[model samples]
Target: MKRDERSIRVLLIEDNPGDALLVEEYLEEYILRPDLKHVERFQKAKPLITDGNENYDIILLDLTLPDISKEQLIENIKHLAVEYPVVILTGYSDLEFAVKSLSMGVSDYLVKDTISSLVLYKSVLYSIERHRFIRSLRESEKRYMDLFQLSPAPMWVYDPETNAILDVNEAAINHYGYSKEEFLGMTQSALCVKDSNEDAAEKIEALGSASDRTIQSHRKKNGTIINVEIINNYIYFKACKRVIVLATDVTEKLAHLEAIELQNKQLREIAWMQSHVVRAPVSRLMGIIDLMKTGELDMAEKEQMLDFIFSSAEELDEIIRDISAKSEEAFSDLNKEK
Candidate 1:
């Protein structure tokens, strides 16, 4: 009945009725009134704790039990306790075993003789709180790893001080043609076509968390060059100051822009030919017509002007043909590009 409606649930694995009753009294006297479950041995406790559905706060495990005890007992229960903190209950003389169990993943050890109601209560609450914090930290780390390692774009972390590669994502391995081990052993310069900024280290120090991005050329393993825009962000990870880099390849995009520019230049040249060369002969023809209208030339001069007009017309026709030819060529080139 006490296990049905308490906040801090605990599992007590001890065969001694005296010790089990003492722990139960200590836990119940606390303001929280922790719900306690008592099991005689590790064998019966396995199903109650390891079902994944039961959410016990902590375990009070005695070193001596009927079915399981001591180091092997801790190991057996640890494999079942996904996140529940196990506090070992031992005699004062078993301090060495208690210390070893602490290193083996037990939360904390309590000596049975000295542990009063208040002391036992405090140890249970503290162990639960500490274990909660530990589990939360590990979950945060796993989430960060998932986001970085599973991304589709190439990304890596490098130490700004030494320019050494710290870690790389799966995308980086496939994109750069380097294995994970090889990338870790290399520096940023290995993939760079140019040593762009010798003062990047100083800049990263000055910028701190507010890192900027820049475009540069990078060399691949097969000796091919690619244009990339690299972004930088600083983070303190694993006791090192590192910069997280994201490289986006822009070589094909740049090539497409260059092609568009060349097409624009060709169109400008055609426009110039139309306005300058094609208009030159038309201007001469207009001037000869004006002379004829003003009657400025007699019969012989008018014949000479007529001959000049014919030559101008012939030149204009040639200029029109040239413009048409160039226009056709430009269109053909554009079609090919498409």
Candidate 2:
């Protein structure tokens, strides 16, 4: 039958010719065709094992070799286990040793007397796939650690039960003005400002299973308080459930917003002066001029009306100066921020 999988390359390290032939025949009888390289001595396999010229999916190692001692034989197999999955091919007499080899990193062991084509094929496929999976898991974890350590924003991992900080990144160390050792010895509550601690806890508790994000006041090592937006997610770290946090400082952002609001309030005051206060004096001055133009008053009444007009003019000048001062105050505050 045509095999559905790719051909598996195997290296057989055995001194006995018959045992090597039997293993090859067992694989040939199965539907999975494999490429097998056989060597009779440990010295002959050293070059292939060390040099990267040949890449094999798995190794079928003999429990005994002619040139190497039993202790040295296990040492060699341990080294090979790092590169490829290893299966022990042993006689009945070495069954105990073969079982012990499994603990020394051997993938699987099979007795020469009871081996079948199907069993051999399945062991090869299973060992190779399992090794690939384990290697992939290790690579993924390395990538995650790389990102965590190299992140630009403040990041940390903490245990939720005791609120103890587990791990902290370089950015967090610099931002909080704390050493890594110091951070690890402290709890998350120590970083929070006293006033916000209870409110932050209530918001985190209310989030349930979802990620928690809220703006909070955090105290630094130098007793400087800053506002930060903290976002945390639940994750499994080193087989224990933990929370990972990312904090973004929003202190300057909030200050800028407040300044803009104050400037807006000042501008609103100037607009009120223009619309109501300045208009009142100007309207009075125009009414006094209209009464004088009507010629319905005596000389003394006219003089009194002129005095009222002069008073209204002075009020208008004072209102104009007040509005100009408010406008200057608003722009001056804005310029100082820049």
For model 1, name the residue pairs that clash.
none
Candidate 2 — which pairs collide?
Answer: none
lDDT, each prediction: 0.80, 0.85
Q: Candidate 2: minimum summed lDDT over ten consecutive residues — where?
A: 195-204
- What TM-score fits each model? 0.81, 0.80
Model 2 over residues 1-338: C-alpha lDDT tens digits?
65636788999998889888988888887645678899998899889988999999998888888899888989888888878899988899999999999888889998988989889988988999987887788799989998999899999999999999999999999999999999999999888875244444444445462344577788899989988877889999879999999888867766666678899899888888889998897888888888878877998998898888888889988888888888888999988887
The predictions' CA RMSDs to the true structure, in order, are: 5.4, 4.6
Candidate 2, lDDT over the whole model = 0.85
Which candidate should be chosen as best, given lDDT against the real structure?
2
Residue 15 displacement (Å), model 1? 3.0
Highest TM-score: which candidate?
Answer: 1
